[model samples]
Structures are given as structure tokens and as C-alpha cells.
Target: MQDEAFFDETEQLEEASSAPTDTAARKRAWRLRINYRFIVQHTPYILFLSGLALVYIANIHYTEKKIWDINRLDKEIRELKWDYISRKSDLMYNSKMSEVSDKVSGQGLKPLNTPPQKIEVEKK
Candidate 1:
């Protein structure tokens, strides 16, 4: 009789524990279904907004690169202009008619001994 009671008590305990496990499984399944439904409902909007953000970021990066290129070109242009002006000044300071004549002679062009007389034409 004592052994029969012990067996009955063990079976009751096992049934009680398995009942809670089944309840927990049902709760977890319900939560998963809710999460899936929420994601399915909002997926399109989420994807669209992500695409727009990516495009905006790409445009900003391209504009930044272009601005940097323009700044670099401006600096280079200023340096070239400065070099040109300095060289022009040096040429103006050093150039002379006699030196030009010497350079012309070196290039095989003979210098005229006398200035040519000018002729003026009147327009009617």
C-alpha cells in the first residue's frame, strides 16, 4: 500500500511539471508570432527610408570631394599666375633694343643700318 501511494505521488508530480512546460512553450510561440507580424507590416517603409538615407549620404560625400578639388585647383591657378607675373616683370626689367638686336643677329636676321621712312595714307 505504501509503494502504491509513492508511485501515485510521483506520477502527479511529473504531470504538474510537464503542464508548466507546455504553457511556457505556448507563450513563447505567441510572442514570436507577434514579432513576425510587426516586422512584416513595417518592412517596406524601413527599406525605403534606408535607401533614401544612403542616397543622401552618397550625395554629400560627392559634393565634399568636388569642393576639395575646386579648392586645390584654385590654389594651383593662383601659384601659376604669380609665377607668370614674376617672369613678366623680370623680362620687362632685362629687355632692351640692343639686346633684341643681338638676339636677332644670333638667329640669322640682319639688323638694318638706318630706320625706314614712314608713309602716311589719308582716308577719304
Candidate 2:
């Protein structure tokens, strides 16, 4: 009976020591296991989400570029408007009678001193 009891105790001790190793193996296998079935099942949804994300990023970049273009165009338009106003003012000043006479005086072009008279001929 004593030998039988000793054999049972030895068996229990060995099982207890081997249990930790078995649990460690199971943990390692669990970590390494890949659930390919689940991934395959959700592949369509994953691809759809990836495409949506790409589109969203592209839209953001496009919007930023459009805003930049609009700002640049607006600045260019303002500069062009200012240039037009300045040129128009210069033309207005140069087209005045006094300014024209002053410029032509140096070239010996004098202003007319007399008003023209109109003559009518009688039908004979």
C-alpha cells in the first residue's frame, strides 16, 4: 500500500510539472494562430474602407489646391485692377487739352487763335 501511494504521488507531481509546459505551448500556438477565415469574410469591407480613406485624403488635397489657386487668382486680379486704374488715370491726365498743348508747344504746334466761320452759297 505504501509503494502504491508513493507511485500515485509521483504521478501527480509529474503531471503538475507538465501542466505548465502544456499551458505555455497552448499560449504560443494561440499567439501564432492566424484566423484566415475571419479575414476572408471581412476582406470586402476592409477594401471598401481603404478605398474610402484614399478618396477622402484625395478630396482634402484637391480642396487645398483649389483654395490655393483661388487665392493666387484673387491676388493677381487685384494687382491687375490696380494697374488698370493707374494706367487709366495716366491716360486721363495726358489726354487733357492743357497737357496736350504743353507737350505740342515744344514741337512748334500752336493752338488756333480764331474761330472758324461757315459760308453758305446761294443756288443760282
Candidate 3:
């Protein structure tokens, strides 16, 4: 019985060797190196790694967005500072005694040329 089974296996091997060497057929005959048990056991670790990678990517994006916002805010602050300086200078120039007289002159107002005399009243 052993000799007959071995002889039949050799014959099958010879028949397969004589068969056409089709690349498509060979590709379809691929075998797994890992077992299903190992895959199922390590699935939780794979999912954890995937979750960590996603969190890392999200953190990078959030950091980049914060950097962009900081740059934008820096530009806005610079512009506002310049505006503040210019407005302050304009206010200083416009609040001078000369400018105040000039503006009020159009409305028929004039500056006093002499000091006013003080009068003392006695209470009776």
C-alpha cells in the first residue's frame, strides 16, 4: 500500500511538471506565510498603530494651522502698530496750540492777545 501511494504521488508530480507553465495560474497559486491565528492575535496592535499614526498626522496639521495663524496675527499686529503710531502722530500735530487756533478761526473764534484783569469784590 505504501509503495502504491508513493508511486501515485510520483505520477502526479510528473503530470504537473508536464503541464503548461502559465504565469497567471502560478500567480493564482500563491500561499500565505502567516497563519490566520497570528493575524487575529495581532489585530489589536495593528489597529493601535493605525490610530497613533492618525493622531500624529492630525497633530501635525493642527500645529501647522497654529503656525499659520500666528504668522497672520503677527502681520496684523504690525499693521495695527503702524496705524497706531501714525494716528498718534497725527493727533499730536492736530492738538497743537497753532492748529487749534487755525481750526477755530474759521468759526469766528480768536486767541486772546492780552491777560485779563482780576477784580476783587468786597462782601458787605
Candidate 4:
């Protein structure tokens, strides 16, 4: 009986020493699992924010290009409008009916000496 009790006490001491190692291993595993879960839960949000930032940068670039294009087109349209207005004024000033008639007369056209006879139309 004395030998058996000594053997049992040795076994209990061995188990006590090993207990802390098992507990430490279990705690390490639990920590790893929690870290993995944290990474998994937030990974998609991180990727989504990164994608949104890239899209916002691209949109800013596109809008800046469009604004420059609009400004260039507006300047071109103003230049064209000014050219059109100047040309229209020149045409109106240079091409008078009296001058046209004088040119026609110079090309052997004579004015009518008599008045034209009037015709009446009846509408039903």
C-alpha cells in the first residue's frame, strides 16, 4: 500500500506539471482563432474602401478632363460666334439692293417704263 500511494502521488505531480502546458496550448489556439476571425471579418471592408478610393480618384481625373474640354469648347464656340457675327455684318454692309440693281443695269437690264396690270383672283 505504501508503494502504490507513492506511485499515485508521482502520477498526480506529472499531471499537474503537464496541465499548465495544455492550458497554454489551448489559450494560444484560441488567440489564433480570434485573430483569424478578426481578419476575416474586416478584410472585405478594407478591400472595399481601397476600391472606393481608387474609383474616387478616377472620377476626379475624369471630371477634371471633362471640365478642361468644356472650357476649350466654350472658347472655340465664342471665337466662332464672333467670326460669324463679323462676317454677317460685312455681308449686310456690302450687298445692298441698289448696288445689285446698278450691277444688273450695267449687265444690260433696263427698268420697266410702264406700271404692271393688276389681276384679281377669286377664292371659293
lDDT of 1 by residue, 13-118 (tens): 9989898989899889888877997678889988999999999999999999999999999999999999999999889766877777777887798768899989
Which is the leading candidate under TM-score?
A: 2
Rank by TM-score (best first) = 2, 3, 1, 4
Candidate 1 lDDT score relative to the true structure: 0.91
Q: For all candidates, what are the clash counts? A: 0, 0, 0, 0
Q: For model 1, what is the error of residue 65's alpha carbon versus the real structure, in angstroms, after optimal superposition?
A: 0.5
lDDT for each residue of candidate 3 in 9-113, tens digit (9 for 90 to 100): 999988778666754465455423145655677999989999999999999999999999999999999999999999999999999999999999999999999
Q: Candidate 2 has which clashing residue pairs, if any?
A: none
Which sections of candidate 4 miss by over 4 Å?
Answer: 1-41, 97-124
Candidate 1, residue 15: how far the Cα is off, in Å: 31
Candidate 4 global TM-score: 0.49
lDDT of 2 at 14: 97
Residues 1-124, candidate 2: write the lDDT tens digits.
9999999999999999999999999877765563665577788998999999999999999999999999999999999999999999999999999999999999999778899889999999
Clashing pairs in 4: none
- In terms of TM-score, which candidate is stronger, 1 or 3? 3
When summed lDDT is taken over every stretch of 10 residues in candidate 2, the lowest stretch is: 30-39
Tens digits of per-residue lDDT, candidate 4, 1-124, equal: 9999999999999999999999999999989887998679889998999999999999999999999999999999999999999999988876887666676887898667799989999999
Number of the candidate with higher lDDT, 1 or 2: 2
